[model samples]
Target: MVSIVQTGVANRASVIAAFERCGVEATRAATAGDIEAAPFLVLPGVGSFGAGMEALRAAGLVDALRVRIEAGGPTLAICLGMQLLCASSEESPGVEGLGVIDAMVEALSQPARPRFGWNRVVPEFGCEVITEGFAYYANSFGVCERPAGWACAMSALEAPFVGAMRRGAVVACQFHPELSGPWGLKLLQRWMAMGVAAC
Candidate 1:
């Protein structure tokens, strides 16, 4: 079963529906015990960096997430959820991220700070989850400093940002898989397949 960390900021119902549409059963996990009871975890987020982290802390999920991911638990973070995995973000200075991955989230360098549309992403460094296709994106901040080969996909929009990154069992995406149509669903399916294998 997939445990979705309930940050109370993301579209939790929509994400769960997406998973169900793909024939995957997912549960919303709010407490540490709920999080620990699942085989795999999905962290979804929206809004500013500070608010997201605050919600995670308020829900007392930070340490539980850290422990799970560090223990090699399969995880997928989406949008602001992915940004929260970084060490820090320029979106809200002085706010610390979960720091599971050594990277920083910064404002997109594109003309429009918040890019809103379908953008094409190409897989880099032989990433298994990232495939070349159009994925929906609506974000003001993204991981600009990709840790070399960890970048699963690269999007040229917003001055070539890290569209997706993966290390071991932890995977993150700046795009919303729940809203990216078929490509997004396929990506989630790939994630579930990987999660099943890891189990």
Candidate 2:
């Protein structure tokens, strides 16, 4: 089953609904025990890095998530959840991340405080599963470094920033797929398929 980690401050309900719409069974995991029992995991978030990370820690899910990933579990992280996977975020400096991806989250160079609309993203390499299209983003912070190859996807604001990233069984996106309409739903479907394949 796919477990959506309810950090208590994230948009867990919508994410769970999105997976269900894609014909995937998803459950909201309120505790570490629930998280540990899930085969596939989804970490959905909103707000600042420190708040998000602290919520996970308070829920006793930080270590559990690391353990799960170490075991090669399929995981998907959205929006702030994606940022939390990095080493640290400028939005919350000195706050260590889950360190799943050796990258840093930084404020968007764009003049806009929060990008709240549809934006086009292109696959840097030959990323087949994550198709290039217009996806909705609603954030002020983005991945500081650009994606090197197929392992990441790029989107434009003032310049290119990491929009989507993947490493092994883990895939993350800065945009809200649950609220991105059709394109987002398609992306989630592809991600769900990948999660199933990983399982």
Residue 34 displacement in candidate 1 (angstroms) = 1.9
Model 2 misplacement above 4 A = 110-112, 147-150
Per-residue lDDT, model 2, residue 166, is 78
Candidate No. with top lDDT: 1
| lDDT tens digits, residue span 66-169, model 2 | 88765667788899998887779888888889987778888885443777998987775545566888888999998858544328888888878888887666
**lDDT on C-alpha atoms for all candidate structures:** 0.84, 0.80
* Steric clashes per prediction: 0, 0
Cα lDDT of candidate 1 equals 0.84
TM-score, cand. 2 vs. native: 0.90
- Per-residue lDDT of model 1, residues 1-199, tens digit only: 6788888658898899889989889887889887777777899988889999999999898898888877767889999999998899988899989988788887786443777989998887657677899989989888876765365788876378888987766789999989999899999988878777877
Per-residue lDDT, model 2, residue 193, is 77
RMSD of 2: 2.1
Q: Estimate each model's TM-score.
A: 0.93, 0.90
**Residue 85, candidate 1: C-alpha displacement in angstroms:** 0.5
